[model samples]
Target: MARVKQKGGLIGCGFFAHNHLHAWQEIEGAEIVALCDRDEKRLKEAGEKFGIANLYTDAAKMLASEKLDFVDIATTVATHRPLVELAAKAGVAVICQKPFAETLSDAQAMVDACKTADVPLMVHENFRWQSPIRAVRAVLDAGTLGDIFWGRVSFRSAYDVFSGQPYLATEERFIIQDLGIHILDIARFLFGDVAQLSATTRRVNPAIRGEDVATILLDHETGATSICDCSYATQQPEELFPQTLVEIDGSKGTLRLGANYQMIVHADGQTQTLDVSPKLHAWARRPWHNIQESVFNIERHWTDCLNSGHEPETSGADNLKTMALVFAAYESAAADQKAIDVRRMA
Candidate 1:
């Protein structure tokens, strides 16, 4: 018997949604049958570019009418709850963009709605799905690095992000909510669930409304400690816009992922360097290729999980833990570097 293709509808056709559209085009078992965006001009532009004729201005209208297996909500954080609830009521799976919610209560409600509907819910957090990060996890799993004790996941760039997403500059919270979510998730992915967290933040870029710098310390349940730091104010001779540099120390060895996708593992007096760069898909451009590839990887993961009836790695339930860290970091920073117990957030 041949496998069935899952027909999905995409909402919010602005900026980053383009990547989602392109990624869905290449996914084998999925097809985007409909698109909905509040902005008529953007909807028309994206519909024309992707040759998608099924477009709507209202998401409720799309869900009420289209026979969809899933709905991908690419809208901003404020709209997540209502859109997710709408999808849940429609009995369709949902994949939401991160940061998942403005508040933990909303996050819990969205998760509960999906649970009540018995439909899959995934947050489109693509950082860990980045090939280099996957390679790092492979190294850890293979025991080449032995029992991992400490790690650092860092993303610092002075690249002009506001040029594309101008709205980001005006948001109340910047790096942590936007970029740090991914880095913190990477820390969780490598080090395990966090038991406690401490953080500090500062707004270095006067041009933006939120902090451009954040440093968070995580004490993992696995008895490992890790640091997740991000800065949009750091400038270097070579700009690593979308690169996430990682360093890990273990019982037996150490691992380092440097700029230009160079990954190195050192153990037992031996060292290996490999290029873990992401492949440039036909529609992908430079600098953004890594993130673009991850968009594709995560969408494929969603389809595979949807088809197999398996929970996604970043499922709504699992993302709650990651989402906790995000809230904890901000709370910690606000309380003057107080250590926060992750459990107390609920």
Candidate 2:
């Protein structure tokens, strides 16, 4: 049976939104019917490029006028709550970008709005959708890793992220808030809900306002401990920019996701090496192809969930736990890296 394509309206035609637009074009169950942005030039450029004639400079106007099934809020953190509430008010589902809100209260409000309106709300937490990450999860699920006790999710690189998104350099919160949120979420995805968290952050790059280095320790509810470390200040020989390297140790053996998307697993007296690189989409380029592919994967998942009337894996309510970890990390860092009880905070 051919399902009717779900109508989607995308807000914020900014730097990262291009990937959303490109991925939407490839989605069979959904299509972005309208585009909105305060910047007229970017809006028109996106509309013309994507052949989306229904365009608006105001999101409210777009929501009131277009009969969309869902609104994809790809804007920055500050605007998420209002946009999400607006979408919910219009009786439409929402897919909000990460760093869900400036605070957990606002995120809860948005989640409540969607629940009140009987609409599905998903957060665009795409790191877990990455192919290599999924492959790593597959090993854990296979139980070959066996009673995972310790792990590390590391994304250390000297990549100049500010080159494409200059606003990142000016923000008071950097690596942890922007990039580490994804890494932390990945930690929760691979392990489980964190019980306690402690973090130490430092501003190694004098050029940026926020810390470019952060190492967070997590105590999972499953009695497992893991470290989520990120550093944009670290310069490596091969430069594993935009790549998340993971290592997990269990009762049986260990699994490692190294540079170049290589995965090595050892268990039961056997070791297997495999390449778990993401497929390079037609519109994607090197280095960014993995992220771009994950964008498509997650968007497709959103449509699937909508069609099946099932909740998304990274729904608003589920993401609150991830958001809790983000806030807890900052709280821990500020309190001299004190270990925080995550469940109490959440």
What C-alpha root-mean-square deviation, in Å, does candidate 1 show against the real structure? 0.8
What candidate 1 gets wrong by more than 4 Å, as runs, is none
Q: Compose the digit string of candidate 1's lDDT tens values, residues 1-346.
A: 8788999999999899999999999999999999999999999999999999999999999998899999999999999999999999999999999999999999999999999999999999999999999999999999998888999999999999999999889999999999999999999899899999999999998988999999999999989999999999999999999999999999999999999999999998899999999989999999999999999999999999998999999999888899999999999999999999997774
For model 2, give the RMSD to the true fold. 0.7
Q: Give the Å shift of residue 152 in candidate 1.
A: 0.3
Mind giving the per-residue lDDT tens digits that candidate 2 earns over 1-346?
A: 7889999999999999999999999999999999999999999999999999999999999998999999999999999998999999999999999989888899899999999999999999999999999999999998998899999999999998999999899999999889999999999999999999999999999988998999999999999999999999998889988999999999999999999999999999999999999999999988999999999999999999999999999999999999999999999999999999999867
C-alpha local distance difference test of each model: 0.95, 0.95
RMSD (Å) per prediction: 0.8, 0.7
* Pairs in steric clash, model 1: none
Where in model 2 is the C-alpha error above 4 Å?
Answer: none
**Residue 151 deviation, candidate 2, in Å?**
0.2
